[model samples]
Target: MFSFRFSNGPAAALLTAAVLLTVPGCTGPGAGQAPATSGPASGGGSPAGTASPGPPGVFPVPAATLSIPQVVKDVEPSVVTITTQTGIGSGVIYRGDGSIVTDAHVVEDQQRQPFKSVRVQLADGTQTNASVIAIDDPTDVAVIKADRSNLPAARFSTATPEVGDLTVVIGTPLGLEDTVTSGIVSGLHRNMPPSREQPQGALDLIQTDAPISPGNSGGAVADATGAVIGLSEAYLPPSSGAVAIGFVTPSATVTNVADQLLKNGKASHAVLGLVPADLSPEIVQRFNLATTTGALVIQVSPAGPADTAGIRAGDIITSFAGQKITQVTDLLAALRKAQPGQQVDLTARRGTDTKTFTATLANTSNTG
Candidate 1:
């Protein structure tokens, strides 16, 4: 297997363009996002006692404050309900020519959960048969292709969002056709292990406070102006003792994963073979460390490349290559951009001395 090199330029621009041209939809990350229309606003009806009838969602987006009716009318065409013989999910249109993306678990058998045939139901309730055009299970994403062209595509966002922003979630969740919910972004660079629900792998989930349901999988989670920023994957169950928490795969991750699917049906991520902990102020005070922030290597995997390079616990990783490591995800983003097996330089602080080391990469499940 070969290492991956996904430059975050060309395709990212295309995704941004698609989103800017699209209208407001729905969202649900973990916290801090635009508010959603409370309760499914029924149909293209005006809000209680409001004389003017707005678009389907009634959310103010872009140039004019688009009404609920306008949002529904503009974005509905691009929200496709994906269902297969094995499972069902959602997919937002990415191109005008019937190219859409959804969670790979809903379409691929990488986990041996067989999918016989896939079908996409448009917002108009028109169902078109589709096939697996591309898939990358490491990211739990897949792209579907159909014979139809000139279809409506959803909008995408380029800026990395801040926590505490309003979020809107739109999908046919749990088989619910065309349902939209609202919430706020709570956390950023959330690294969570997979559960019984999400089967691909650990994800750097964008945590939101939106209401996500079973059928909400693979839906578009966007911010103000109806531009997508993340893809809904899982939600904190009501019984989990959590308040309106939802999880999403960030747009940056989505763009990389989607391009791989469109190109070779898969994508790869670099692995450092160590679990990292962000050294917060409290930890700094306890350790009386030099810098207030840096990534502390907690455990090094015995079989990982980092372990082979003699990376050990108690090593405070301050930087990777030339990029400063303010957080683990920051390092993750940088590594994802680097090709596996490629040499990487790091600045580590052991006690009072700063050191540098070079490590070769490793690839697993077709990616590194």
Candidate 2:
């Protein structure tokens, strides 16, 4: 995970909580009981590159005490090496057949360069040329089916994670093969920016300190049960380090959306028909912030929800259907609580006066 400056800080826990993942009590390390499995090669940097181990006292969450040699033996056959003829990444077997899950950006034409071919290298030393089965570009998740079925499958956790469980990341980073890293779940309920690299507005993600690298995308993050929890994504770089601070996509979201792609090659979502932005504390002061809370409205789409609701520019959102809006993330989170065609009661501030309006949510579609 990337590091944020801690000098003038929030709390020691907040720094640890960033790049956060939800960790369950018994699944993490040192809160007392010994770990049943111990996994290693943990810390920031590409699975192939190294700067230095985490500052002396920083220890890793216990990986399955199960030995790496054994893990490789049991899991490697299912853990295939991926190469795009020009790029590299890792994948996980999601079914008994040869179907694998990896980052969409890892397999398709990305902003960096278009991929020529994506080949999977099996553990038996057999290499097979593969084609994309489907991709969820919105979420940056992709699925590729091998030529055969009856393949070994990775395990997934059916249980929900707590706030402090140990999290393990397994991947082939920076072109390296079968690497592992560890860290605590920093925090949860996160949302990342939408961009060319990531189309799906960042959904629920498991924040972790586990070291992630270039090749780690689409790799697995499992709990102590050896059940998959999330898919490794990008690193959140600390303003200070050359190495990146990493993130992962939650497995639940992956499972929910992948099936749709395989079935129809696309998914549907809702669009607000507006661009949201942050309202700085300074701006809050100048505008008297209505109530010092809510997403700041910079622009309203013509004939869109805001305009239809009679909302205008410079209005700071104070509440959404009765829920307080502190930031853009808060508003987005609230959006999920509603459905298309439903009325969304919005409260905004224009100077010292407060007002509320109702805008009907719109249904939108996405294919990744």
The TM-score values for the models, in the order shown, are: 0.64, 0.70
Q: Write the per-residue lDDT of candidate 2 for residues 1-368, one digit (tens) a residue.
A: 12222110011110110011111000112123232221111100012111234667987553344443444454455666677633466777877767787766567542322244578876566778777877644455677877767777876553456667667777776556777777767767666533222222354666777786556667777665456676776564344453434567766666765766677765444445555556767987786665666666776667766678888778878788889887766676667546667887888888788888988866544100
Model 2: per-residue Cα lDDT at residue 319: 86
Worst 10 residues of 2 by lDDT: 8-17
lDDT of 1 by residue, 1-368 (tens): 11111110011110110001110112221123222222110001111111344688895432333444455555566787776543346788877777787765556432323254577888878889887776654555667786688787777665567787767778875467788777778998664421222211234678888777654667778765566777776655545455676778777677777877677655655666776666768888898988766778877777576787777888888888799987655665566567667888888898899988888766543222
Q: What local lDDT does model 2 show for residue 124? A: 63
Worst 10 residues of 1 by lDDT: 14-23
lDDT of 2: 0.57
Model 2 TM: 0.70
